[model samples]
Target: MASIKLNNVTKSYGHGAKALQVIHGVTSAIADHEFIVIVGPSGCGKSTLLRMVAGLEEITGGEISIGGRVVNALEPAERDIAMVFQNYALYPHMSVFDNMAYGLKIKKVPAEEIKQRVAKAAGILELGKYLERKPRELSGGQRQRVAMGRAIVRQPQVFLFDEPLSNLDAKLRVQTRLEIQKLHRELGITSLFVTHDQVEAMTLAQRMIVMNAGRMEQFGTPEEVYNRPATTFVASFMGSPPMNLLRHAPNADFGGKPGAILGIRPEHLQIGATGWAVQVDTLEMLGAERLVYCRMGDEFLIVRTDESLSSAPDIGATIHVAPRHDRLHWFDAETGKRLP
Candidate 1:
């Protein structure tokens, strides 16, 4: 496996009036055998950054290196990396065995060696029994595994996953995500994954890069991004239901406020005996816990509450939504930059 590095890489489309920079000057290093997740919103350039590394998109400036060798001039096939696309991209008519063996065949690996490698990958992906079936016959999850298996058989220097689980159902996504994690652990290959899903980023990455508007917003561990976000955008975008910055803002949503945004996660907001009194707009019971969407000042916020509370508030019920003082976060009112 190889360590990947990008130096001041950029990508811009067209000239002058029609020009738009899609990838800013981004520089980072992904170490050997590290599982790095690149996450951002739609149009945030996460995929573009990944495609650049995969040699599918050219870098406008600077260099990209794999295994200490500059590969900016190399073709996709010459990069020594296997990419797993968002769509399974398996051949419709080919059997799973044939699909898995295609790349090795292209490289002219011996037939016995190809069979050995494909069998090993199929066994690891739990697809050994489906070798004779075509892609259409498999479930979404199974098809995704086959796509991954195709990558595994190549035994390249790196594995690139471009949101490979996005096509599966919610339940299947979770299961496949776990399998991918386990597979990564077992294989220990340098892998870079791209996804817009924050949960996927949080769960799969050893280190994650959060991108915004083609720029690097933050690059750190999942805890570092979620707990101590470098910018307000990172704060609001990284959590489930997100942190409630409204409670800390005197006038939150409409501007002219003290800060551009105040940030806190849903889990940080709790029902307390004393705090800002709120009007409950809705109460959503989500099995083990409840979500209390309440009005704090002029802004609405979501708080996680215990399901066994003695008295659950009515839709219009007044209650107190308090934040854990130690876990609070603040940002500049106008710039949306995190306050120190």
Candidate 2:
């Protein structure tokens, strides 16, 4: 296990006047055996950042260090890192055992040692029974496990995962996520996983980096990112229904407070008798909870409530809802930055 460090790391294409910069100055320190996840929307530079750490993409400026050694000029293999790609990059003809042993063979490890390594990895990943099966003979989930086993056999200082669970079905994704948690607990190898799925980031990361555009929006534990976002972009991007950002508070009657935006989560607004009066525009029942889309004048917001607490309201019916004062978030309207 090893620590990874990035100091003002950046990436760009072209040069001089025509240069298009993708990653801005991103700086962070990942501790040894830490599981860090980089999450963002598509084309937001999250994957580019991970690739830079893997030495697969060149940094335009600054430095990258692994286990205290600067690796700006090091190749991927020389960096002592193993990568698991989304497509389950496995050999079609080779059996599971051979695919996992291929890397060890390339390094000229003894046959007995290779066998032992493969067997141990298979046992950990529960692939011991399918060692003789080829890639085509296994299911998608099984194939993914084989790919992970191959990486485990390398015993690299760092593990890089690029949307490794994107190809699996919803149920398999959940199952594999559990397996991944177990793997990390047992191996304790430093890992960097990149994904567009916020749920995955929230569930898997010990610390997560939330990216937007080409900048690092925030880096913290899931609770910090979700509870107190640093900016409007983080506020609106990280949640499922997202935060309701309004230019004016409902029932204030004076348009809105100048230079400030109010942010409240869907669950933070409660239906009550004496508060902002809103007309219920729509309602969606989602298992144990319900989403109520409401309108107050021209501003629109959503209210999330438990289905067991009360019955659903009819569309266009007027209802009063109160915002939890403690949960309210304020931002600078012009800069979209959180306010003190």
List TM-score per model, in order.
Answer: 0.94, 0.97
Candidate 1 structure quality by residue, lDDT tens digits, 142-195: 999999999999998999999999988999999999999999999999999999
Residue-wise C-alpha lDDT for candidate 2, range 20-66, written one tens digit per residue:
99999999999999999999999999999989989989999999999
| Residue 39 lDDT in candidate 2 | 93
Candidate 1 weakest ten by summed lDDT: 250-259
| Full-model lDDT, candidate 2 | 0.93
Stretches > 4 Å off in candidate 1: 247-260
Best by TM-score: 2
Each model's lDDT comes to 0.89, 0.93
Backbone steric clashes in candidate 1, count:
7
Looking at model 2, residue 285 earns an lDDT score of 91
Model 2 off-target regions past 4 Å? 251-257
